[model samples]
Target chain A: MTDPKRPRDPDPLADDAFDAALGARLRAGREDTATLSAAVLSRLAQDPRQTPPGRWLTPAPMAAGFAGLMTVAGVAGYLWVPLFGAGGEDAILAAALGGLVPGGF
Target chain B: MTAEARAKGASEAMDALMRGDRLALSRLIALYGPGIRAFAAHQLGDASEAEDIAQEVFLRVWSEARRYDPARGAVSTWIWRIAANLCTDRRRRRAVRRFLGLEAVPEAALPDDAMPGAERIVAGREQMRQLGPALAALPDRQREALLMRTAGELATAEIAAAMGLSPGAVEQLLVRARAGLRRTMGEKDDD
Candidate 1:
């Protein structure tokens, strides 16, 4: 473990004072955070916490949903090919005229 | 307050929060909010985004109280980890927005206009003028380590836990970060 007291830099230009001053400046920013704290608390009051979501939204469920969707699309495509493929004259006519005609062609 | 007192308070607040005392959330916020905001502002160079990250961090604490494992680390460490992760995520989103032309590239210097009144005064100082961009220019890990130490009040070991780095690595990063900032600020002076 690196000892916090040990000087790691041999460079004469390394200004430990400057770094400490910078750290102080950074810490100085802390005083102005009352507005932030109030804002957070106000937001907390506005939005009540809900129970944590279980594994319902995990990748496994998402993947299963995708598989279900793909299965649906595949079944649709399989049925669609038999009706609307190049050999299905009636299917093509019906698709072309179905919207315009009261009954499908 | 002393560090020990602050840690004890934070621990008590976390326990209260876990016990469904919503008011304890305010105490936790009062304790950790400033450090998280400071760390986020310095790391992202955007005050508005820093506020958002700070708010989100507390919200997560409220909603995810069950996830807190005291055996692993202190409440401060856990909260700092949340803040750091949110800042990292926000920075990544900013980069993606820039890449997609939805957001402009951030200026090297900090945005004084968007900064809070006090931060503006600090940024307005002549010597401190270049510090922001010099800080922004440091390597991401180095900047994160330094900000956690300075702004987040995280010890080397706490930073290591938050950042998933060894304590030695965190110390090296701090050393290099200060060196890099000095060089960059010096160059700005030369120019």
Candidate 2:
């Protein structure tokens, strides 16, 4: 005899049958993985993104250096007018040289 | 291998993949390729597209292996989530293309002449012919939950995570999906 307090298994047979049929049909839809995997690996090999991690590091430091140089140049250009008093080429040159040499001004 | 052993192996394989090990990726493909393909095939209704989706899923896996956290879930769950999202994105793109009057090329018809003795293929095509419309008629979330449950063989909790739903919501979606499928298929709702 089944336990009275136990929860009933609802739609047991029907659910199982439906799921089994569905799973079987889906399995039948399977494709050839070897060819697919080969294609995927080939694409991966060609993709530069998949290159070794440090392969990107080589360009990264160079990019950083270039960015740093640009930032310094930008700061210098911003301070050029203020320091040189917006006068002539001689003042600009003097300001630049003064900034480079400590207490030269 | 036991489930524990398999999980450990998968985790190790993922670590190796993150470290740029191609053999580990090959192992992963051998392990999870069929499940991904089947899920994509059922969801998209096109074998070639399914193959493409499967490959894309693995490529994403290879690219994003560093982001995988075993503490969050199993590796299979992570991979299936990627597959599910890719399938959803493809469907959405197709819909948008249709809306924009960009005529998407129709999937090529399967060549019936290729395999005369493949009884499973014959039977599956017939079943899909009868069932495809009903399956497609389901709401996207319900259909995804149902397919991940039935075809992907994922547990409810895993489905919830993949669908970004609470477990309770996932159960409700699944129940509604089953009822909808049964009603459309003309099955008696005895339960």
Candidate 3:
């Protein structure tokens, strides 16, 4: 696999030796998966929680959609306020502020 | 089993798994589990993490079967690409934990209290013990490339496709990885 013309090429023999050594070490470290296999297979069989850990929410798309919705809602609310009379504006402000106070709005 | 036979078995298992056959999923796990585990173990320096990866890989294979395109690559290649991606995510999370001081640096290998000093000095065992830290010391990409090559038993082209790199780039990575490992191991880099 080594080409002398290629600057990336090191000594071919040494590379092979390194690979062999690494491969051996990896093989030795290989996990015995009988118990894991059983657990995983049973989980698949029972259809326990399809999503992997920490991936259940899929936050990006949801967060983007939420932000878009909030922006549009804010813009729409701002635009609609001008059409409302001063009384309506006061009513809206009171309605919004009421929720911030203690007890039911 | 021959590579041909193994590939054939994995393909059949994948097909069955897509049909919702749990037994076929088990077979697929049996086929690729060791490699995925070894790949993860070497990458994360932890067996428990490796087990998590192996289990997750199978679950992913079960769920994402429809997304698989046989024309793109072999079954092993597809499975390994998933494993490689999971390993990347895991390593990143591990790094973040370390950065936040939420994690302490754990020993790379479990201490074998049963093995006496003389027995621990055996050449292969000693070399294997040394490798954990040496591998951990490697830069992420270099370590990943080497682990995928060695532990995943992936061809360079398969690795390239998995890593979204050209075959030439994969070759360069492999060469650099080997050189890095050599340097870490106190071997002659010129050699």
A1-105 in candidate 1: lDDT tens per residue? Answer: 899999675653454455557766665545555676677677777767642242234446679989999999999877887774577866666688887888645
DockQ value for model 3:
0.36
Residue B72 CA error for candidate 3 (Å)?
Answer: 2.6
Which prediction has the highest lDDT against the true structure? 3
Per-candidate local distance difference test: 0.75, 0.74, 0.76
| lDDT for B158 (candidate 3) | 77
Per-residue C-alpha lDDT of model 2 across residues A1-105, encoded as one tens digit per residue: 999999776685787677667755655545345766787789888983664343234445669979999999999888776764657567878878999897889
Models 1 onward score TM values of 0.73, 0.69, 0.76
Instruction: Write one digit per residue (lDDT tens) for candidate 1, span B1-191.
Output: 66788899999999999998877887887777767776787787776777778778888898899889999998988998888877776776677778899997554333333346865666554434567778888999999988887766676898999988899999899888887987887888899
Q: Give the residue spans of candidate 2 off by over 4 A.
A: A1-9, A12-17, A48-105, B1-9, B104-118, B187-191
Using TM-score as the measure, the top candidate is 3
> What fraction of the reference structure's interface contacts does model 3 contain?
0.46
**Residue-wise C-alpha lDDT for candidate 3, range B145-180, written one tens digit per residue:** 788778766778878877788999888888877767
TM-score of 2: 0.69
Q: Which stretches of candidate 1 lie over 4 Å from their true place?
A: A1-19, A50-105, B107-128
**Residue B5, model 3, lDDT:** 85
Sorted on TM-score, best first, the list reads 3, 1, 2
lDDT at residue B89 of model 3 (Cα atoms):
76
